[model samples]
Target: MSDDSSMLLDGLPVAFADGQTIMEAAMAAGIFIPHLCHHPDFKPQGSCKLCTVKANGRYVSACTLPAKDGMEVENNSPDLNDKRRTMLQMLFVEGNHFCPSCEKSGNCMLQALAYELEMLSPHFPEFYPDRPVDASHPEVLLEFNRCILCELCVRASRDVDGKNIFALSGRGITKHLIVNAESGRLADTDFSLADQAAHVCPVGVILEKRHGFAVPIGSRRYDVEPIGMQVERPATAGTPGTRDEQA
Candidate 1:
């Protein structure tokens, strides 16, 4: 018979409450499962597919897959990691991510994951898509070139900020992030730097102006510790549910 409150994660026992997803259970147990689109504060969106794991011989998104008693989840396997590496590489090349110059470098989940997954280079040809840099907002800057389409901003804006200032448009390779304004400008919306969406981005897409490199390169969040370790330690996740908690 299956235990009602526990399961096996990678051959290790893990206990979880009812209604917790595999990712949530793993996270509560301090097990690192690579993910991009799922954050604790928002409803799980499984859009990134980085958290896909083998659950009882079937592949499913850990973020959205409910944790069942006695279920065995395969995470961190070589096959899974290899696939995740390829996905990370695709994300890197799909967007214009100049990490060295990005304000979000050490604090960026994507860059940190690339290092964690040992993705040395963007394995595919760069699209180098012509995106815009919207500095129309005085306190914040929107660099669309580095957006990975994780929709953190979209969820945060609509759910938390209640502005619905950001949204994803188009489809597939043509899909891109868009400001929900008639002029296609962030300033045209009521997005403020204080909003939750402004701080939830995993990449360099949304940044604050006039504060670039304020934390320095080497002393930043992921610079001091890998993302996995940070996730395991909530105290170091930044601001106790405000800053970098989604990271």
Candidate 2:
């Protein structure tokens, strides 16, 4: 695929390859588009809807939508941000995200994006689902309460680690992450700390047993910089504060 195509991301021109998705092009050009399930390392799962943007008048998931030449995309608009903020609030309320007490506080992508999107509160009523915690694994801990259904761990486990340790069950709001074992425990499965699944969780769901608070609050990944800056992108000459751009 040739890398000669170009598109307008919020009026700024972004060059893309023939097969590159809008998200890929934007990121390559150092344009931050907020997302959770569409990691660059994994297949683009458009389940999280967080990367939805207006492309040529219609809304589409930037991570899944292929970039076209001369396409006009609106990313940081007020309406789009408003919708994203609502989604963030719902995600917060859907799970028991006690960010202060959680081990993934400063390093969590969800938490960082919430702050970036200016999510002041979990606007809707909280679900507070009584999910189980799996401490049966010798080296890893599984907190179901923090699962955002992003399926990053599932992908990592199946595709990268080839362990198939994780899967999702149920439907709609009842859908949840489940261990791929008859015993329904992490210990029953071959989930190792070395597996990509152990480190791919954007939230506090899949965690190590004793590594809590190893990094201080102010020095964690997102603590040092925002989530938008977590991924390395090509630096543009004029955009001095591209990292601080509206994500």
Report every candidate's CA lDDT: 0.86, 0.84
lDDT of 2 at 56: 99
Error of 2 at 168 (Å): 0.5
lDDT of 2 by residue, 1-247 (tens): 4567799999998999888999999888888899888777787989889999999999999999999999999999999999999998889988889999998888777899998998898989999988989999998889999999999889988998999999999998899999999999888987787776777687898777777777777877678887777565322223343211211
For candidate 1, write residues 101-210 as lDDT tens digits: 88888889999999999999998999999997998998888999999999988998998889999999999889999999999998898888778788788888887887
Candidate 1 deviant stretches above 4 angstroms? 1-4, 232-246
Best by lDDT: 1
Q: Looking at model 1, which ten-residue stretch has the lowest summed lDDT?
A: 233-242
How close to the true structure is residue 45 of candidate 1, measured as C-alpha lDDT? Answer: 89
- Separately for all candidates shown, the number of backbone clashes (residues 3 or more apart, or on different chains) is 0, 0
Instruction: TM-score each candidate.
Output: 0.94, 0.92
